[model samples]
Target: MKANPKAKADPKADAAAAPAGSKKKLMIAALAAVLLLGGGGGAAWFFMQGGDAAAEDTPKASKKKKKASNVKPHYVPVEAFTVNLQPENGEQYLQVQFTLQVDGPEQATLIKDNMAIVRNRVLLLLSGKKASEISTVEGKQQLAAEIQAIVQEPFAKGGDEQDVTDVLFTSFIIQ
Candidate 1:
């Protein structure tokens, strides 16, 4: 068999086919990268703007919360009381002084206006306590709670009630 020496190698055809396949692959990779970046950017923008929109929607509520937080608490002082405690092995007495914590001036005024009734109630409650009942920290705390409850109760003849948030004992002595 004799080879055809006049026929040339088709280098152009091989080059053209390889370059087309490579170009298609390169284009697909580029498209995927662009789509990934675009989707990530969109998600980031949505999350960042979502928080801002919610914050902008409730500005009044935020202001109300700030004002409520800024409001100061009012404290009303009660005169010291010396009451005879229940005898435990001997005659005992308790001398206590406390300040009442109220929400605002109005509540303080309410408690101040009924000082006599409040004092009487507190005295009655304190006089009933035994010396051993108020000797320890826990016992004193329990006594303070009972006193607060008694003082916060509604006054006689259906008077307006007072809200006592806390009872702070300035002085507590059991003798």
Candidate 2:
């Protein structure tokens, strides 16, 4: 009869021990998961904030300031021009309108003040062009260069260059 009682007690002890072991394993796994998640989140925050000292060493923020150049260009618009082109197969005319990009506002003002001479220089240059030469893309680019050269020339002998940097065509027609 005592042996039977001991046997019953042993079975109950086994049942309780099984549940306690399982509870210990569950707690350990939950703690591991929480710690891993917290560590990963902290790592992400550290990297996203540019890793502290890495930011100043690399000067990544300063690159943007360098890219923001301080030089500001100015522009001057010219009236449209119409001229009879040099004969090619048949008589043709050209009409073009463009703006001049200058280095500064002073250059723009100088061109505006000498508008008569500027117009003459451009008109004479256009009147000498042939219809075919001014019709194609390359020809148009060449024409812009020539116009820049002519406009950039000194307004008078021994004077400073007019500072015309670019010719931006707004309208063009060769017919």
Candidate 3:
């Protein structure tokens, strides 16, 4: 209850107060050091990735390329054709039905739009062929190749070539 105006405070209290102050300072320093190191490490990692914009864009570019390449094939079906073949030994008739496998939907649409020309071309080719020329399997394959080439031709002068991949024969009958 008496004031000790001439004496210093207790030594135990001073010692305890000193440690408390130093503890706060130590914590602050440790926190600052951790923040500095963490930020530096993150920056280093960011720059270490070669810093190339192209490298960053590569996966997305490749994904888009893959998607383009993965476009679904489109088939354009042609009506059956019955044409009298060139008589080798006797009267012969050839009836054939097939679909054209094209590279993409655009080609399919083009073919569909110009179907009259397509049928005319194919009919002329078939009518000119002899029955013996398309009787065997090899002959049929050859005929298919010829049909594909005919269909692959551009509809107009200087237009891009149509991508006709295959001629799938659904029916082939010789009578």
Top candidate (lDDT): 3
Q: Write the per-residue lDDT of candidate 1 for residues 86-138, one digit (tens) a residue.
A: 98878988888999997678889988988998998888888888988899999
Clashing pairs in 1: none
Q: How displaced is residue 21 in candidate 2, in Å?
A: 24
lDDT of 2 at 63: 47
Candidate 3: misplaced stretches above 4 Å?
1-68
- Residue 152, candidate 3: Cα error in Å is 0.5
Alpha carbon lDDT of each predicted model: 0.84, 0.86, 0.89
Each prediction's total of clashing residue pairs, residues at least 3 apart in sequence or on different chains, is 0, 0, 0
Candidate 1 error regions (>4 Å)? 1-71, 156-160
Instruction: Tell me each candidate's TM-score.
Output: 0.59, 0.61, 0.61
Write model 2 residue lDDT over 1-175, tens digit each, in one string: 3466544466788999999999999999999999999999999998886566555567565743333233366889999999999997888989899999987778889999998999999999999989888899999999999999999999989998876768999999888
**Candidate 3 displacement at residue 89 in angstroms:** 1.7
